[model samples]
Target: MKTYFPYQLKYVGVLFVFIAIVLSCIGNVDEFMRGLLAGRNDFETSILNEEATKVDQTLAYQPYFSEKEKDNYLKISLILSLSGFILYLFSKEKSEDEFYQQLRAKCLTQALLVTWLFTGLIYWIRPTYQLNGFYILQLHLIFFTIIYVYNKKWKFGTE
Candidate 1:
């Protein structure tokens, strides 16, 4: 298949993935802070005390607190990372050719097979663990990218 995006799009993909990672970090930290706060109920059982949630007002609870914001960060980050992954997948190398196309196809197939095996192992070891289809696809995409990058154009830049 013909590449739809220019090599420059890889930069955009990198940016998106970076942003997604940052957002995910922020979300996890927020959840952790909330848990820590919630756990510090002082010498009482009530959590409505000012000392519980007055930690300089975290990024997630600024201005007002809403339950919706708790989950939105995760969803937004996932969407952004997925978008970035797709852009990077379709973007062309500076020197794309038939050989590169065949290599890409082979890498993707290998990634899929490896992902399936990994998923199966995970399930077999931890039957309680659950993975969604989207997560599986995301894992496959990551495997494909890593394989393709190392195989085709891994380099230590001096610039």
Candidate 2:
């Protein structure tokens, strides 16, 4: 059963989710290995002797996400992608068929701009709490922005 998404935003959403999942898995693995090695032997002791009492603190900042938040992001991403896919299905063809493309491009561009504003505010606030999911959302915003910009300027279509 195919649904409509109003535009082809679903592919973009899916791509974002896929990228986020892969990056998150990689990050988790790296963190687990580092923790494991730290506790496996005298490595931590050696680090302590090196006068680095706060070795872990010096590492790259890892965003923290509550279990509920993680689940929510995943669910939202899936829903958004599905909606986009459905829109694509229900779209009607114009005489030139460029109107729909342009409309979708504009919509995506607006979404990206809005998201960028949010992310910019996040950067300015110097937040005490960080979350990997937030970063993923920001990335998706930029990604969609780029896609819209590219498609909007292409000469292949005329609205």
Candidate 3:
């Protein structure tokens, strides 16, 4: 079968990574602003009162993103990360042979394994409250790192 991603797709993957990073940074800044603003007594009291009766029953003092803003960033970041992953995964190799195909499969499997294990470890160690906004942010980084390491180790079909 023919490869779906051309050799040029590697560049697209890189571009997606850049976009993800920028969007992630903006999300982080928004989070920081929320936290900073929440420190005010009036905002803190209002938030606590508003959230105390919610079903979550957790801390009522936590910072929250505006729904629209959070959803926009989440959707954009997810799309960018997924696009980057697909491009990186299917991009044509220099020598698209049986060995390269085997290596690609191996790498993909290993990456999934590593990502799942790492996520499990984090979940085991960290509180759910602490994991809120950071989960998606870390997921993209983990995926990129795994793919990058495998590509570097295999020299991306250079063998």
Q: Which stretches of candidate 3 lie over 4 Å from their true place?
A: 34-66, 127-141, 144-148, 151-159
Q: Residue 58 error for model 3, in Å?
A: 30
Predictions ranked by lDDT, top down? 1, 3, 2
Model 1 spans > 4 angstroms off: 34-67, 154-159
- C-alpha lDDT (0 to 100) for residue 79 of candidate 3: 76
How do the residues 8-91 of candidate 2 rate in per-residue lDDT, one tens digit apiece? Answer: 454565565465565455435545655665574346556576645466555434545555665665566545544443343234
TM-score of each: 0.74, 0.30, 0.63
Candidates 2 and 3 compared by lDDT, better number: 3
Clash pairs of candidate 1?
none
| Model 2 spans > 4 angstroms off | 1-53, 60-63, 96-159
Question: Which candidate has the highest TM-score of all?
Answer: 1
lDDT of each: 0.77, 0.53, 0.66
- Model 1 residue 131 distance off true place after TM-score fit, in angstroms: 1.0
TM-score of 1: 0.74
lDDT of 3 at 122: 82
Q: Lowest-scoring 10 consecutive residues by lDDT in candidate 1?
A: 56-65
